[model samples]
Target: MSDTITWGMMLRKLPSIANAIPRLVKGMKVANVKDPTQTCGLGWSFEQATLRNPDGPALLQGEVVLTYSQVNQWANRMAHHLIAQGIGKGDVVAVFIENRPELLVTILAVAKVGAISALLNTAQTRDTLAHSLNLVAPAAIVVGEELVPTFSAVRERVAIEATRTWFIADQNTCKPPGIAPDGFINLMTACADGCADNPASSRQVFFDDPCFYLYTSGTTGLPKAGVFKHGRWMRSYVSFGMIALDMRPEDVIYCTLPLYHATGLCVCWGSAISGACGFAIRRKFSASQFWSDVRHYRATTIGYVGELCRYLVDQPPGAHDSQHGVKKMIGNGLRPGAWGEFKRRFGVNHICELYAASDGNIGFSNILNFDNTVGFSLMSWELAAYDHDSGAPTRDATGFMRKVAKGEEGLLLAKIDDKAPLDGYTDPQKTETVVLHDVFKKGDRYFNTGDLLRNIGFGHARFVDRLGDTYRWKGENVSTTEVENTLLKHPTISEAVAYGVEIENTNGRAGMAAITPAESLATLDFSELLAFARQQLPAYAVPLFLRVKVKMETTGTFKYQKTRLKDEAFDPGKTGDDPIYAWLPGTDTYVRVTEQLLAQIQGGKYRY
Candidate 1:
């Protein structure tokens, strides 16, 4: 990608630049939070939004439309109910609900009570789900009726009392009373009797308090609870909403991403709230109907992931692709290859791509409407030389890390200081695992982002790849351990190692596993293994390709030689004695991947 800023691109961005100046000027004033302990938090922000436009459209889902007053009043009632239940500041409340109006209201209510909302991933089940719930030790849990069955399967594994289990009916509850199954309290009915006035706790809550515990995939294969504070929320409220997007009251943001994730909850929804604009949502994303929903909501901006863009671009051309009203977009993981196709085909003007981790201290915004870059960070950041073989940073003769030259891929690190603190994770040890000390000078500290980036000109950088064992696929980070753990449960598999390999036209890596059969390769049932894998793991986490080998190669430390496996990939020619197999998209069984089939798959014949 060219690092130079062309005059034609500048001229094309003239109108957007003109409109963004006022928003950026106004946003920078409130974006500064020198003293987080002294500033108000989420409750204050939401209340201010309600006060801004009481009757303006706040949320739209399906045929339902809620005003700012309606949502605030609903959340206020729930907040009062929470206080009655002995829940208050610093308490953790596990919110086990899918993407819906109830999920947002539950979190907002928890915010008003000054409690941390532990947003549970809906795709998780069995052991993974139990680990996340027990990690936080929530004071209470609010479950949507849709997820009650899934939660009930593992309720016995948690420590919460039956009475403390709150449930919101799946059906719309216009009436005061709603139905709930046994061992579940109807949260809506109980809260309906409470006062609908905003609580005094809103002002009492400060920026340092925890607002949400969003999960990120851990190297150990389990999810880690990343602490997201109100102070960071202030950054998102300003950076994406006020500075980058600059949305108006009439603008509606159509977000189809999951609410439990940072990009959807904090960035997209927070930006909508910052402008007091309409926030439209759906339970799940469907590429086929994406344009129809955008048109129906009249969304001016849309939330997207890299894979989402690829899916849309993969669809057959249609008039709605370029006929929609969407003019702007805000999200991350949009690949450079599909960026132009998505923008040109959809008629979007500005792609306000953002870069930030739920647990890290650094953030970047595309404020100047730049292409193929994360833009720039407001705080101190460094791109240091990395040792790819050992997966560590390189040290110079002085025993200090060296900075990678401009236009080179290097590991990204952020300074940890009072100005920009690393919020870290629920587990202190896990948080400490990411910290690097004495990088440049003695006693100096930095947070390792575990990401490689190439520094372009103009203080901007382009994202390169994620380091270590974990790789992202289907917009979700796939842990090698997680996939390997699930693979071990198969009777025929004695050993397994998982890694991601790049496909020809795909945005991110595709999951592949090298396995050793317990008996002979002919004795193993590929169909049975595929069935077992699909049952044990999420669809995205399941390995797409399988390589059968008699002996698994390892390093001197007994670690699987994943680098070799990744380089060999699923190509049968590369694996001399070992045979390779592939589970094609929409297929139930694995088939032998020969040279001819590999060429056909890579030549755009298959839609994987």
Candidate 2:
């Protein structure tokens, strides 16, 4: 889709804007970031919802359903149990659970006690798990039944003691005694005799106080724990839930994304609670079972990641594709290439693609249901000219960064102030890495988003690419995201991971792509594939090397594992069984790269 919004399109969206006025007013009242007197947090929001819709379905996972009152009371009981175990305000409790009602219940319980729930990535194990555990230094740990084995393996390496170790059964145990491992204490069982009343500590939980510690998806390296404060979650509730979806009690948001992530935990869940709506969660995403689950829940909305949408689109067109009640979607990374296809296929009215880092203050939401845009931000922000090589904002002779052209791609910078405060990573040094001091003017601070965006029109902008992900090739810059999106547009390419690779004698990095075909690589048409990339991309932007694989590896959050792919490059030894294809210089067709040909190419046999 074009970044420019035509007059006709703007006129069409005028009605949507008109309809959003009341929501905007109501949302602003709750979302007063500048108001010092205002105090909003997760527990406060949940308790308010209990008053509004006590009997309504608050959470659903398969046959297990929890009402607002039931969920609140259960969480309260667990809160008392935790307090009894000597856990108090600001203490970190590592919640190690998969997608389940109990996971959320545990988080709520911890929040009510004014303790921080360090949402550990369930995918983590061994050394990585120990690193994350030791980093947070959780005073207590909640291990899910399914994940016990994994956690048990690394338990010896961690610091927490058995007295503080908590466990939740795979099944509901809130009302009855549940079985626990020898060394583990059943959280639900312990809470059975505790008070079910709302804790006074919930009200004391301030906006600036850290509510949860969400680990960043470790795509580039070891994951960093990013602070997710109550203020941020409340902002999401008012902005995404109250304003964007205006979720009603009848609305049920089906989420298949990992609950540990902000997109699922805060954005989707917060939205549901904001309107006293139902929230349905699945253990993990299954593309084949996705639609079935949606239909089962009678979901009115969905929480998605771009990859999930792509997987659904990749599913063969069936009669039941558009046979669901889903009207809205809220999440991030729905690529422009697949946005239209997803909308057209699924028949969802609003694809509210959002843009926000767990560690960053600024957030953009597609409240107007705009196509191909991350939508708009009300926060003070700027698009600044940047140096791709250094991956930093480029400043002028006056030592001030200039704003990018209205429609050009630039590094996104969010102004850090009293209203838009940056509750960054746990490590002070890591947080400092993202803080841009004296950005536009003396004494002015900006949160370097490290993302490139195109300012389309109004307050909306289209996501371009990650700052470091864009490669300088030849004399021009090439965006890996743009290239990957272009590759995905092809009918045969099921998955595409684009990155920069260094050639032995090349002036700069060359564009390379690792793609997984729908069928075997034997049937893939090289000429057609080359033509598709050429038609959609520039000469420099087109990948010089193409690696065909049966599967594409991704992180827990569904981001491509580019670090490993870049290391393998186009070498047979490094890539193993995966076949490498290359678009050689002066060649019209892509050819297989044998060890004999690879030597010649790397020895500067031909000019690129």
Q: Top model by lDDT, which number?
A: 2
- Backbone clash pairs for candidate 2 read none
Estimated TM-score per prediction? Answer: 0.79, 0.98
Tens digits of lDDT, candidate 2, 26-70: 897787655444556888899999999999999998888889999
Candidate 2 stretches with Cα past 4 Å from truth are 6-8, 33-39
Q: For candidate 1, write residues 144-234 as lDDT tens digits.
A: 8889989999999999987789999887754455778999999999998789999878777776789999997433368899999888898
Backbone clashes per model, in order?
Answer: 0, 0
- Write down the lDDT of every candidate, Cα atoms only: 0.85, 0.90
